[model samples]
Target: MKICFITLGDIKSIATMKRALGMANPLQALGWDVSIIALDSEENRSRISIECNENVQVHYYKDCSAKEEVAIKTRLVNQICPDFIYFCSFSFRNRIIKSKLKHKPKILIEHSELASSIPDNKGPKKIALRLLEYYSVYYADGLLCASRYLEREYHKMARQLMKKRLPILYSPYAFNNDVIDAARILQQELNERYKNNTVLLYMGTMTRNYGLFTMLQAVEQVTKQKPDIKLLLLGRGRHLEEAKTYVQQHGLEPYVEFKGYTPENELSSYFDRADAFISPLNDTVQDWARCPSKIYMYIPFRKPIFTSKIGEPKEIFGDDGHYFNTNQPDTLSKLIAALADGRLQKTDVNIDEHSWDQRAVDFTNWISAQYAVRFAAAGSEVFS
Candidate 1:
């Protein structure tokens, strides 16, 4: 079967690109023709180039006016005549594209709850965007929610719109095998630098909602009892400087190290040397919808993961990792102390089910089933 994957983001976007390719690669391996349609931007054009394989086709469109871009996408879809179209994000243009397509099955891979994430008082823009998101969900043949919580929420919303149940798939974020192999390589220097300390690693955006400050606070409390605990943060964001200021004000310089914005390929080296992985996500609509891709990225290294009992993490890592309640720095401090004292053990839960290959196979099978149902409804034979 031929499948066309579409994303509104530039091809070089770290998370989106990786996810799009992750799903495509496995489909290609299963002898399916997969094509990725991405918005072209100078940022992606300048970064790197993809070596498209025989089974997978890559197409990038130059930046254009909204009307022109939609027209170009419509033309491309007509030319490709794909059996299915998978969208990576929701936008007005994408919704319009869905409206234009008559027969091809479409799937919306919702990575976030965009409507709730938007702050209040944006006026008509917010209303329009929310409606677009709702219509996108209401009209799609199926949904690929990044977390179970997201699946439940979107399923209810879509049911409300259609007055019937819609197909929803729980496909969490995952990492490719290259990341796993790279993390297997050890860096002697980093290993030596962190040899004597209990290394706690946080690798993602340094934002408040992600609990960067909460982590710092917990680390500070942990260090008061165990000075050998080290917190290694890797990633850059708008709140990086603010976090640094808090570290300074609290005299956490000796306990914390910020290795800003490490490339995805080079992340495994940091992951290799860490004693544990941490995701201190706060409870919010935005976070509830988010399936922390970093957790999958950290899993291959066979490390203990520390996270608050948030939506996806709680559902996925239940009893496997250390879980804490919201706003409970004292509880987090105890977990850290246990790790520092070598009392906490790394989780040995089997992660084969979460692998990209498995996720892709599941997605392909689901797509096939959806297509069969559609064909049956129309009294036409489905593609084999």
Candidate 2:
């Protein structure tokens, strides 16, 4: 089977790169010819992909103009001629999806988050986004869901809005074990500076929507009880300066450390250095709507993962996970304090079962079944 993924992002870019590559890699391993069609706004950026997956072909199409992009995409899709094409991140580049070819590629819509319900969006723009979301979702022959909440919601929405049920597959976000294995071999020499201090790490966006303030508050309280605890955050976002200002105003310079924007390839080194991790997930509409990919990244480390009991984290970790209320700083602080005083220990989680290889098995089986159904309806034969 051949699969082509279409996403709006630069080569090896952040937005859709993680999920695209995660699925593409395993599909290639399963003897499927995989191709990725990425769109970049930068005209200067090279069309070549420097990703580790050599088997999977990466074609970056320049988004200079809609007409030019369509021409480029049309030519490339004809050349790739995949059995199916997946339009990711609510992107509706359906000129090709609606086109004719020998393969007669089936369309699959893959959503990582609730695009229309994105936080801080308002007014006319929000309405425009909702319309766009509805357009692509309405056109899909099937849905590849990232979380169970999304699967249920989208399934119901299809029936109510379109009066037709879309075949939904719960293909949850997963961790790349390749990075984990590489991290295990690489031991970042952090003994000189952080020898005595217990490093509590966080490695994603620094925005308030992700609960950066709640984490800082918890860290401040943890520092009072356990001064040796150090909260090392390793990402940058809109709230970086604001978070820094809050840290300064609260006299938390000695306790908090913000190491801004580390590359994905080099993240393993820092992951090896950290003793424990924090994911300040909250109970909210936006939070409940999507699966947290960070939790998948944290689970493989088998370290103490301090997070809220909500959404995918609750489902993924079950009893093995640590739970805390981010709304209550003291409660989150006490959990961090447990780790600082040797009360909390790393878990022996069965990380192998959750690997991309495992996720690929589920994806391949489900997608093949969906393909068979599509053929069955059209009075055509399915794959072997």
Candidate 3:
């Protein structure tokens, strides 16, 4: 079957981009054709080759007005003529989907974070998003749940609106196979550089929702006892200036450093170099909705993973992850200190078991089974 992935974000800059790329190679191996459409960054539309193989065709248009953008998407939709169109987040196919595509391809929404869960989205904006989300959830042919919370909540949501249950595919973030060798090479370099320090790594958006300030606060507390401890933050977001200010006010300049958005290719090395991984998510609705993409990415390295005890990570990680019940920075401070002091132990996670290739295999098998079931009930005419 041919599937087209439509993303509204810049190429390789969002979760959906990675989700599409992670499953592409495996899907292709299983006799599925893949194509990608990027709505933002005209330069990146053509450069999709950098991330995907030459076999995967790409589509996009140059800078244009909103009306022109809609026209371009409509034309591109007809040209590809895919059996399925997979997308994610707020905008429906980056804010445009055919009134009806040529093939009537199925729509799969890979849920990330919902606006209602966000603290900033309040009043009329939140209500509007709820309406949009309600329509999007029921309108799609199926859902691709990123977190356990989303899968459970949205499944119930869909059931409340319709008699038939919507098809679901649980595809969380997985490690990149391509980065293994590069990560190994970079690990040795990082080992030599941070030999004398307690290095903890964090990679994600620099927003309040992701717990940027909470992480820095933990670093500030840790620095009091372990002056040489280091927290390397990779990625920049809206809270970058605020994070810097927190570090400065607390005199954590020596302990905390912002590395700024590291690309996907270079991330694995940084992962290997860290003594532990830090993802301080609050016990908020947004946190519950997300799968903690960084947590899955960190597992491959088999390093100590530190996160909140709430949601799916606690259930999935088990002994593998260090969990904290409190949102207090002091609670995290103790854990970091324990790991750095060799008190808290590291657990090994089977990399092959959680690799993207493995996830893709499960994802494809489920998809194939779903198609077979559909064909059996609707009589092959459904597939066409």
Q: Compute each candidate's TM-score over C-alphas.
A: 0.87, 0.88, 0.89
Per-residue lDDT tens digits of candidate 3, residues 1-62? 67887766664366567777667776676667788776557435433554568787777666
Clashes of each: 0, 0, 0
lDDT string, candidate 1, 144-253, tens digits: 88877778777777877873557788888876776666543447777888888889899888887677888899988989889999999988888999999999999999
* Model 2: per-residue Cα lDDT over 1-384, one tens digit each: 677887665533355556777777676766677888876545213322323367778777755666566667767778898777787665434345355454567788887677667767788877887787667667778888787778877887787777375678887777887668664333536655788888889878899878799889988887877889888898888999999999999999998999996656567777777888888777876677777777788778777888888888777777767888877888878888888778875566788777777887787778767666222321233554
- Candidate closer to the true structure by TM-score (higher is better), 1 or 3: 3
Cα displacement (Å) at residue 252, model 1? 1.6
Positional deviation of residue 266's Cα in model 3 after best superposition, in angstroms: 2.5
Question: On a 0 to 1 TM-score scale, where does candidate 3 land against the true structure?
Answer: 0.89
> Cα deviation of 375 in candidate 2 (Å)?
15
Candidate 2: regions farther than 4 A off = 11-13, 40-51, 92-103, 162-165, 183-186, 345-348, 373-384
Looking at model 2, the pairs that clash are none
